[model samples]
Target: MSDIQPRRSYVPPAVRATSEWSWRLLLIVAGVLAAAVALQTVSEIVVPLAIAVLLAAMLAPITQRLARVMPAGAAAGLTVLGTILLVSGLFTLVGTQFSNGFSDLTTQVATGIEQVRDWVRTTFRITDSQFDAYFDQIKDSVGKSGNLGDTATAVGLTATHFVAGIFIALFSLFFFLYDGPHIWGWVTGLFPRAARARVASSGAIAWEQLSAFVRATIIVALVDAVGIASGAAILKVPFAFAIGVLVFILAFIPIVGALLSGSVAVLLALVAHGPGVALIMLAVVVGVQQLEAHVLQPFLLGRAVSVHPLAVILAIAAGSILAGIVGALTAVPLAAVVNAVGKHLFAGESKGEIEQELEENADKDPLARR
Candidate 1:
């Protein structure tokens, strides 16, 4: 008793937690900021590689199957060739149709605009002066924009960047499909010998998660596209198939993407069909999206990624802020895979157990090529 100091509660539980998490949260933010800076610094190289990785993950099962039937290199080449052809065909079809029908579409749109104007004037009792004032405001805003030459230069640069990104993605896709295992093995080899197995296991788990996420997303997208497109077709909407394709592609971007694509379809319908058809299209969009949000996504992606909705929203927001469209597209899958791998490692699962779990996952994988 003589030697012991009087016991005292110097730390309040609330204060202690606040202090403890404050520093940890700060550190996490700092680390994330540093990583973001580094990524932006090497965006050109990183963007293509990241896209290739996701595409490679999507095509991995097919690649593996094709490899068994043929040489790995030839299989990868063929897969890449097929993807290129598919994309080119889509673009060609869209461009040709757009070019051929643009003038007619423009005329129809002009007529639709007049109809809208007349309806607005009649419904709201708006005068010519009010309409002219609004139109003048729009004209003033457009007139204040940059010169045509600057716009053309900007467009040219954008097109050049697009072409370069495409080439890089394609080149990386072939190598990733053909030599991804070897590349990953080499990467793991760089780690200390004892840690290599854990690293390899974690990577395998991440890949499985990636594959599962992509495949489930693809399926859900197809379902949404079909559902919405069928409704549009029943409404006898023009370019229904094209709108379906657009919806399918945009559905990759998650919540916002599908909504925007559906809105586009609705607008087109309103212009080409009428208010009744547009209303029907609107109901179709809402119904399909609700089904996706309530049923397919939760069942499929929940099983695959196990990410909370809040986490998905946060990831998408952070990704869009960090890397715009590409980031938004990749964010959810990346977060899910990282979450899976981190949870696996942090749970102290042994490398042996990881391999077993991964094998089980692969066996049950929906997209696994039989």
Candidate 2:
């Protein structure tokens, strides 16, 4: 009985060697891990590349128009040079204003602190002895824990990192402008022959969407900065130009950026002028933000890369959590590109599924029969 049972079932050696599903699952896990590592590496490298691409894309249309009359190489060169000059000039102007503003702020802060102390003593009937004791404690603590050298070193390190980042970014931008198209072609070619066409098409569409988003964002940021600057100037805010530059930079962050920048403007106004002026500055910020949300965004960004506000917020939050300020700055643009691609690739399948579900529901519903 045992001998007969032993010969009953035969399993092929090939079949027993490995399970297809198990192999597939292992591959999937490996692929996921590889992708995660790749994304981390690419994010670091691609940030500057993305910035350069955005800049190039914004300039491309103008360069193309110029190419109609002049040589393409020359057109690209002229465009890049002009952009550099413009950026340098703007930064120079802002730097000058910032220096002056900082000096004035230092003086104002000293005076403001004195005035506040005097007011507190007179209004609250506080004695000078009480304030002197507080100051003495503060001085003793500060003297024991003096960190002026450490603070200066930390500032120097920050400045060094910033300069290095800027250099890398600019270098990336140069190459991006010069060889971006060729690089795109090479990248697409690396895919399988059957997939190359689709990949190329998708890449082109993504670039288009990214370019549009970048251009629109720049315009919006400029408008917001100018509006805030004008308002701050009117309110006699110290460091108006520096605050305006801050606004411009933050405006790229989407919904929350404007609020933060506006708050800074308001605070500066409050310190420099008064509460009444600060309130007026806040109103100006609100009005500008509203105009941007309703008018500028719709018109400038258009429908090409439109993403839902919820999705934008989620992306921003995720980005901030993952990579701090850089992540937050890049999140919306990444989301826009992802959204564009998702709609492009999956829209038909999603629509088909929806239709099929509806048909099945209708078949089951008594009211549909009626």
RMSD of each: 3.8, 10.9
lDDT leader: 1
Residue 248, model 1: Cα distance from true site in angstroms: 0.9
Per-residue lDDT over 1-370 for candidate 1, one digit per residue giving the tens place of the 0 to 100 score:
4998889969988999999999999999999899999998877778888899989988877887898889989999999998889888987887776777778777767766666677778989998899999999999999989899999999999788778988999999998888876777788789999887677677777888898888998999899889988988898676777787888887877877887899998998778755656888999999999999999989887765888768878998988888788988998889899898888789987777866765665443423212
lDDT tens digits by residue: candidate 2, 1-370: 4555445687777775667767988999999678756766665555555566666767766666776798766767777788889888879988888776788887776765666667678889888999999999999998887589998998999677667666667666655555566666678779998665455555655776777787899899999999999988877788778778899989889998988899999877766655567689999999999999999999998788889999989999977866568778888988998888777666554445544543553322211211
* TM-score for candidate 1, residues paired by index: 0.87
The count of residue-pair clashes in candidate 2 stands at 0
TM-score of 2: 0.73
- Stretches off by above 4 angstroms in model 1 are 1-17, 122-125, 355-370
> What TM-score does each of the candidates earn?
0.87, 0.73
